[model samples]
Target: MDTLRIQRMNMGSGLQNASGTDKAQPVGDLGVWHVPQYMPGYPTAATIWPRVVIIQCEGDVCPGYEVTPELGRGEYLFFLPTRK
Candidate 1:
């Protein structure tokens, strides 16, 4: 048997106005970082589980629809035993 999990996480950031010339960058600094507090319409969860962690940043690219990382944000999807 195999176990799979799908979770939607919002890091909390507003969409920049289409007119702005300034490009948006990742919302973090060198070392530690924080997720945005308020996101309209979406109710903030009282208890936040910090188990999920971002492992690495592969790279950035423009993929027709939008600019997204080539490998995307790496994080723990779930745990599964190896099939033998």
Candidate 2:
């Protein structure tokens, strides 16, 4: 998906009245460069760019969703992946 398409998403919010299993559509992958994980001040050549995937969540998986990433959510609830 394109940048505009990603921006148009709901930013990870659970769907009300959602039943059955949530379906996760693989939107795409994002490559972040030198993201400051710890030490929330500034990245002084110590931060590492981690690998993560972006998924367009559907149903209940939208809100408070979590996959098996090595580093978990980046201090945010949104921008997470869902199960297939």
Candidate 3:
């Protein structure tokens, strides 16, 4: 199976939720990177460029979501590969 990847990125500070709550779920002393939902025509477990917000730290793997790059810090891409 193809695996999704994610790299920690510094957003200059902590991230917040829509309800004005701080996403400070420390993963090894790091805050959470709250990803945006509602990317039409794709699985909830994946993300694409320009629509996804880049943030720091390898956050907790969301139930139906996944990160990309599987490496160092920067903008990460999330996508699901088709099986043949």
| TM-scores for every candidate against the unseen true structure | 0.19, 0.24, 0.18
- Residues 1-84 of candidate 1 have per-residue lDDT tens digits of 112121223322223323212222332332322222223333354443332223222122111122123423322111111222
TM-score of candidate 3 to 2 decimals: 0.18
Strongest candidate by TM-score:
2
Candidate 1 runs further than 4 Å off: 1-31, 35-41, 49-55, 58-84
- How accurate locally is residue 31 in candidate 1, as Cα lDDT from 0 to 100? 32
lDDT of 3 at 18: 29
Per-residue error at 30 for model 3, in Å?
A: 6.0
TM-score of 2: 0.24
Clash-forming residue pairs, model 2: none
Candidate 3, 6-54: lDDT as tens digits: 3223322223222222332222222222333322233444333332333
Global CA lDDT computed for model 2: 0.33
**RMSD score of candidate 3 (Å):** 13.9
Residue-level lDDT of model 2, residues 1-84, one tens digit each, is 212212222222233334333333433354211111122233355445434545554433432322344444343222443435
Which sections of candidate 2 miss by over 4 Å? 1-39, 51-56, 59-61, 64-80
Superior candidate under lDDT, 1 versus 2: 2
Steric collisions counted per model: 0, 0, 6
